[model samples]
Target: MRIVADTGRCVGAGQCVLTAPDIFDQDEDEGTVVLRTAQVSGDALERVRQAVHICPSQALSLCED
Candidate 1:
């Protein structure tokens, strides 16, 4: 699975970063969600899922393709 982030929809909540810092980060300027990497490892999927669910703006998703 891969992580997908829509920065335009982000509210700079930082929930993604808190849940999965290894895969998600915040842009320094705007503090919006930023993808550290789109590729998600098996072990990191759990954390990514939590991040997606907890995100206030719902800007993150998983792409199975």
Candidate 2:
């Protein structure tokens, strides 16, 4: 699985950060979503998916490869 964030759509609400801090981060200056990992553990994948769902701007997506 891979994670992708549409930088153009990110408003940096930090929902992804709250859901998966290991994989997502907030940019201090821009307040935007920062993807720390393209691939995550199987256990972490579900949480990442939840993060994608909770993003108010829908900037996050989980791609199964």
Best-fitting candidate, scored by lDDT: 2
CA lDDT of each candidate? Answer: 0.89, 0.90
Clashing pairs in 2: none
Model 1, position 5, has a per-residue lDDT of 93
Off by over 4 Å in 2: none
Which runs in model 1 stand beyond 4 Å of their true positions?
A: none
TM-score of candidate 2 relative to the true fold? 0.93
Each candidate structure's TM-score, on Cα atoms with residue i matched to residue i, is 0.94, 0.93
Per-residue CA lDDT of candidate 1, range 1-65, in tens?
98889999999999888888888888999999888899887889999999989988889999897
lDDT of 1: 0.89
- Residue-wise C-alpha lDDT for candidate 2, range 1-65, written one tens digit per residue: 88989989998899999998999999999999988888976789889989988999999887777
